[model samples]
Target: CQPGFFKASASGEMCEPCPAHTERLGSGALLCPCTDGFYRAPNDPPTGPCSGLPSAPRDLVATTTQLSAGKLLLSWTPPEDTGGRTDITYSVECRRCEGAACQPCGEKIRYEPASAGLTDTKVSVSELDAHLNYTFTVEAHSGVTQFAAQGTPRADRPPSTSALTTSLHYTDPPKVTSMRVDERTSNSLSLSWAVSPRPRAQPRPIRYELTYRKKDDNLDVTMYTVLILEKSSVQINDLAPGTAYLFRVQALSSEGTPGGSSMEDEYETLPEAHLTQNNTAVIFGAAVGGAAMLFIVVVVLLVRKRRRNSHTRQGPEDAYFSSSEQLKPLKTYVDPHTYEDPNTAVLKFASEIHPSHITKQKVIGAGEFGEVYRGILKAPGRKEVAVAIKTLKPGYSEKQRQDFLSEASIMGQFSHQNIIRLEGVVTKFKHAMIVTEYMENGALDKYLRDHDGEMSSFQLVGMLRGIAAGMKYLSDMSYVHRDLAARNILVNNNLECKVSDFGLSRVLEDDPEGTYTTSGGKIPIRWTAPEAIAYRKFTSASDVWSFGIVMWEVMAFGERPYWDMSNHEVMKAINEAFRLPAPMDCPSAVYQLMLQCWLQDRSKRPRFPDIVSLLDKLLRSPDSLKTIADFDPRVSIRLPSTSGSDGSPFRSVSEWLESIKMSQYSENFTCAGVVTMDQVLQMKNEDIKNIGVRLPGHLKRIAYSILGLKDQTSTLSVFAV
Candidate 1:
């Protein structure tokens, strides 16, 4: 008797073929186990054919830099209905989706480190063209030989693995950084800019675009652009003398997609009198007198340098902008740790407020240490100002009280329009309170969501710019905001977003790498960086990652980061190199900045200053956001919607399968325990096959129906169908 045959004779003389869905491996067995993602219900008899559990390996998250070869990094999770088996592995497939046509990519496409039949759920694909989106499919396959004896009806057996798809959102190479006028003559200027560092693996060419236009409000100036390759700076040989011109530089991809640009700056070419060449005669006449003057000027410069060196005890903020002292206003910060007593530190920065001056209105929010209220703070001779008041709960321990007041000590040390102002602290009263300027519009995230569609792309980017400005100020202060997020940003009626909620902020003093290590409290998994989450290293880089999430929230109109993924899953995916996909219709340039903020290497992430600059450029040139980030971030793109109109019962995967006349496989879905539309949204061909679905036509129909539901819900993986 063969492995698929069984003996059904009292005398053991006759061997019969095994029934459908069952297999006998030893050539002559009484019965067979389920095969190919098949599993019988607990009550089913041993003699019956096995039922199948539907499953498919899901490769949902993707990352790319829009490299010349279009490298794509993909990550997936184990299939849910592993058919109750632990021997599951995955395989990958590539499909090129562009301009209304999505077809399987052939051998011409390349997959780094091998493309198929692997245990590790990550893969990198290369050799694809940049600036275009592509689709990918990952399937879950159980050990074929290990389950060789198990069988199902040849036509009904589901494929071992399913296809999981998602969108790949990326941008062109980074824009030029540190752009400035190197030399400006009466009729010419040598414009220079630096390109941000790129990975060695970056095969694409980074082209610098120098755009210039006369700064004139009276007439529309003709915008001139110079495309430069293999160089960071270019000399614009021709310009009107004494003309004030606006200049900006940007890096372009091979496909001509521009990332963010440099801050639009203006510099007037030196007047005609300053131009050189024929001025040698005049110079020679003055040479005799100029020598003495030059000598005196040199001596004065040396004396000033000596004086500056003698008083070189400036704060970290000075060192940050030392090369360009006028770039930022000088602000002094007295570290709270300097004071021997916490109370002394708190009082040094902020004055104590009398309880009578504070009138509580109503509760607005709660935190770990206290309840917050929107209230009034009235100082003598000043008008009553609305402010947010935080009160220490009555039952809080002395330790809790100190921890709560510690924030006041920190906030009071800073002064910036984007930074929340610390009004005053009330410690003498029974309930100690911290007062702050009230943000009429409330938290940025909720506020954006409340008015999602009402904001334009420019307006939204402005809000992000304000947040970045605040973060820049905080970063310059050598402070690490461990829990930066849209929720931590407060929006005022004027739509100005300021950094607030300093509960998780700490000073990273003297850390060469600008990092702070701590045993610490809870980390916001979704908003935190990989290094910060795993190694407890909180740094400005980590804050940048959170800021990227905040950017997503702002672009998505306050959509939650890593939607529908749990904390554990979010960490795992992030660790696996998966990042949050671009928001729907997000501007390509804006997404590019967000991608830089989320670089896995903490040191590689851009600084807040650079981020602020990028946003500034985008705001100056609103046309930069015209090109949208393109990707089918929702579920499968091929499936059709079966769920009825608005606020329907939310169709389950089984019902959709039934609607498509594929109800024969509903039992497989039931066996797989797939209930929601989201679960089915990610199901691939192999997943449907593994669940007792066989036959090309059936799989195709089901696959199309499943993927077409990409827009059916807001909960599915951004890359799945």
Candidate 2:
């Protein structure tokens, strides 16, 4: 009942001898008999104390080749037991045998290459008598047993032995001469190679190492396989269409020697299937015959219809068509470059004014392209007039120079009053310049910041109305201002706002959505529509999204759109269906328009013309401005300082005013008896003005700042609880 021994009586506590090449210890062991390489010698009773010299190695094997005429390769496993020792060595012994008797072939029995010894399980024996029949024997040796004899020590025990006899000849592995792609489809190919002619010999098994990879791929991504083939062909499936692949083949003989690899060959898969040339020709002929018959019938019908309508009375529809072409759907605008002679027609649109007639004054501002300067332009019949001269900076490449001039070409075609007028260009000068009507005030964002709440809601809405009018005009001409933002708009001394920047504008062709697919460019995240930013789709609808942000800018008096958030964060928030909260004290109606412009579905957003009408309506009804929403100042305006003077939260009116950059009004607050932070936080717009903060901008700033402090206090109290 031991692990390595069994008893004839089932379930009885008796042990019997283990099977051959297997052994076990004492009885009652649960596991089965140990296999070869783990067994020990059996005891006298064949059940207990099973430990001794190792058993003979099992599964002895040998092979020979004709290529090495006098050589025979031998390999075998180690013995089943080492007598409880680990250091085991193997030796290959050979003899020249006649019938039954044999004589040892000593010294002449040399392992291959004359370096391998008994330590190696595999050996190649050479220099043998090729005329004599040979027998090869392998013996396993367990070095230096630990046990000592009780009396006289017995002679060193003979090691375990296993033997095999072979007198076979070796043959060279076949050489693969050339490999090629035999056949190919869109996604699969078959490969075949020719083998060099060889002398006839006994049939032997052969294998091929097939390696393949995509052309230009690194070795790390290369794949290979070993195929035991009866023929010299293989089919590889699931290949990528129109992709090139490299293949190599090497032949391995039964002796495990690999021959030289065939030359690397490249092949490309066939392209996807399509209509054949004959089918296309047939379709073309059918379309031409159908079109000819339809044209003849239409000509005859038109002739008959004209005769029938000639006697009929003219209707109002006829009068409508006779008035002007403007009333009809206008033909799509085309880029001037598309004209046959662009040089002549392009010059007709933009005049080339000489630099000598323009006087450079001083630098007014800097722009992405170059610098802006206020200058005087002197024309033949025109008196000196102020103009903004945008001059290209030095060290500009030819491409940059072309982009600089493109804006002038776009502006020249625009004529709306709300659109910035391009007077002429000074391209002949060392620095190319674009001359346009100058605005006393600069960018709309900066103007809003400087005049925060100085202007009433009506005046701010008017500026927005002007911008919408200009955008509507551009939309009518099939133009898309890709980089529309408050910074691109200009304000004049008369409070007039005009759309200015045209560097990124494009005259779209006849597209249903007015969408212009761009490859890639720097996108303004906070101002860009979600779809445009994610997909590089620039359309009039995307421009509406940007205009929504612009509306927020005007209403918030130039606060950063997504306060303190990185471009990546803004993109993530917008993707998650989050929109910017209403700006501080922003009119509910105006904020509603901004939200409409920011609809996730671009088609749902209103067009520029519709926006203009809505703003005009809101402007007419002044009472609508009173409907304000509860604004989340944290997301709109900059957060107020948590720590006031003396490194603590604001506890008094002076400290709260100082935190909001209104330290100048601190004295006014003290004189108005607003001595505590609570009193200041509870104050309203009129109450702030009564406290001597007369400027609408200052009062509004104070009110919002107080609201922010109140929110902060409530947040702190929640956490305190």
Candidate 3:
């Protein structure tokens, strides 16, 4: 016998086709067995009378009714077929449908008629979300008995009827019961609300619409805005100080329908004079008047006193007295020229110490200016303390000497635990030297490299937190450290990090961009922000960008930024929107913060204080560090080759533009002041025309060249790996 067909009995001489609902697995001389959804009938023919299963449930229907606020009533009909059996039961199951997939309705869903059975055809599902669609399935089953002679069992076989499926949608909007002011400030107020109490079956509002206005203002003056909040509280800002306002909130369903509004509440913004501005103004007025009167009296007295002294003054003495004065020994004085920028006003703030107080020990390191040495400083009746002395080299010009000592002037003003402290300077000596508190662990980069893979993520984060704290301190003082990197940070034996170098630091002025334009300097290309590199616009945000690169360095054990790429290449890559990849095995959270810092728009980057807070949160929750970081090496490493594989074409954007005889626009393509190669590559034909490339021939050349460059980039991508 072939599959699906078999003999009726062992005594049969020939094989016969299997009856309905019967199947055989292989060619054999045995009778077929009853398949699923089928049964054997009593007193059947020798050939076999396997009856097919009854049809699935029919006339299936579902209806939903609004029970009350946030509650819904659902009803369904039973299947029409019972498989010729009276003993039957139905099981109901429900799941939420997100898109095409069905997910189990979690704790938010509840079922009425706790256990769905054959007699209980209708089931009420509560706690349904108004924003979601739910699918419910009902299966019907029958129990039948089989005889041994027939070789069929009657245990509950497959459901004689197919499972019925239906969906329910609840669109009831949520009701907001109460609203109140939680807090108020001079310019802002925080409002919170409570939703009306209802069963979990009721759907919650997706958003809240807040309408507010001055208490005495008319409805026309009211301001309205929507708030999408996961919680019940929201802070409203830009309110007039010392003003009274009335607020009302209404809930919005997922369908964008607004429900009833809550009762209005009154709140008064804190007065600007709450800090005793009136009293302070009166006091200041009185002080100014008194000081003016005193100044007049003092001026009159000085005038009279000078007149009297002038009249009482004696005439010049004779030759005898003049000769005696001239004969007197002249006192020796130190020359001001021996000191660096002695005429500069900043020198007045630097404390000059005697060279005898500092005993130079061993040469510690070398810097751009000169060599640094470990030394001991002895104070009167105090213990000798270790210090680091930064000394200027010999054969230096007056300007070089001043530049070397300028760091002392900058450091002397800062006094923070995270900032390196400056001791006194030894300008009186032959070689000018600056002394600072010594750090045992030297530079942060070297320290991290030496201890790679030894410190936990918490420890690394702690170090970053300290660095950010120091940067935050600098930012608060309106100061920007143009050069911020791991090498500039000094680490102590206790693993505390402090910002040290101030060679390129500058005080920010009042500017909307928070930028300090420099005329000339050697910029740190790899660590500089795009605006700073292109326009010399240095701001605290640019420093934040460099700090991000430093973060990568710390996490990667002082790895060189951009690998072995040249500075020009790094700048080009950054302009093309290519960011550094996360270090191997770096935590996802830390790398995410690094990417945030490297945002193209500096304003979007987090401030130093925000960085400190984020690091603190990460440290507090160490488990977050377990998240694996992802990086696409191909995108990050797709750098434009200096020499094309075909041959040497253009080494720089200027060269490329010059090749097309558009040398007049060379300055436009340089990374200084304006346009860059990356920007040129992304420019459309319209952009080229707008940039004064009016000649069709020139425009065609530029467009075709850009297209060729894009093609070359695509080809390079294949070999990037």
- The lDDT values for all models are 0.70, 0.70, 0.67
In model 2, residue pairs whose N, Cα or C atoms come closer than 3 Å (at least 3 residues apart or on different chains), thus clashing, are 4-33, 37-80, 65-169, 65-170, 66-169, 66-170, 66-171, 67-170
Q: Rank the candidates by TM-score, best first.
A: 2, 1, 3
Off by over 4 Å in 2: 1-348, 505-519, 632-692, 713-721
After superposition, candidate 1 runs with Cα above 4 Å error: 1-338, 504-518, 635-721
| Alpha-carbon TM-score of each model against the true structure | 0.46, 0.48, 0.42
Best by TM-score: 2
Q: Residue 102 error for model 3, in Å?
A: 55
Better of 2 and 3 by lDDT: 2
Task: For residues 1-721, write the lDDT of model 1, one tens digit per residue.
Answer: 7787766544657666766667557965767766555555545566666644436655467766334335667787777666554556667888877768888878767564457767777876766754454667776666442333354453465554545444433444675678777887888888778767764346456776666666662322233444555677777767788888777677776545445577777888877774344678678758856898999999999999987885667654344334332332222234565557878878877779999998999999876667899999899988999999998888987767777888898898766668898998998777889999998999888898777566668878878888888888787556777878787789887677899888533232222222324477566777888878788877777899989989988987776676545566666777777777676668999888889989887667788889988888876576798898864434312233334675432466666675555677877898987777778877887788888876654676566655545444553333342
Error of 3 at 676 (Å): 43
Report the Cα RMSD per candidate.
22.5, 38.0, 26.4
Clashes of 3: 8
Alpha carbon deviation, residue 719, candidate 3 (Å): 8.5
Question: What are the clash counts of all predictions, listed in order?
Answer: 29, 8, 8
